[model samples]
Target: MNLLLARGANVSDQDGSGTPALHRATHARHKAMVSFLPENAANVEEKDEDSCTALTIAVKGKFEAGIKLLLSKGCPVNFSYKPRVSNTVSCT
Candidate 1:
């Protein structure tokens, strides 16, 4: 990953679902990758197709380490998500 970043890969690039590598790493529970991506400029607030951020994903997945890392990096504590409903739910 370092080598790719050094070669100028876009750290913020997203897939068709608007899921960035950072979110994928978090979903997969890759602690080292999760920690490393942020340092390389990954956006912690980036949301996926479901409007879920990496922090939310981590929390939903019950990944304590991932949640801690995101929080420590200053990922917003009040992220908002509106599922298919008309109401917005807050993930803290």
Candidate 2:
């Protein structure tokens, strides 16, 4: 990765689907890869084609270590791609 970076590759470069390097790292359960990412890895926060952030995948995958690593790197806990909707209906 260092060589790639030196060759002008962006550490935050996402795939055509916007899945960043950190997302792949989490999926592969690569602890070392997590550390290698910039300290501000969370800044990428680019969602995949499914609109799922790395944090969301880590949480759902039950990758406790990866989740903690992302959190420590500044990933927001309450990040959501879509706004929440209230169940209450308006009274006419």
Instruction: Point to the candidate with the largest TM-score.
Output: 1
Candidate 2 yields a Cα-based lDDT of 0.68
Task: Please state the error at residue 78 of candidate 1 in Å.
Answer: 0.7
Candidate 2: the clashing residue pairs are none
**Candidate 1's TM-score:** 0.81
Q: Write the per-residue lDDT of candidate 1 for residues 1-92, one digit (tens) a residue.
A: 88888799988888876789999999899999889888878888877776678988887678999999999887886765444365443443
lDDT of 2 by residue, 1-92 (tens): 67867787776777776778878888888877776784634353566666666677677667899888878777666654342365221211
| Model 1 alpha-carbon miss at residue 35, Å | 0.5
Give the runs in model 2 whose Cα sits over 4 Å from its true position.
Answer: 40-44, 79-92
Supply the global lDDT for candidate 1: 0.82
lDDT for each candidate structure: 0.82, 0.68
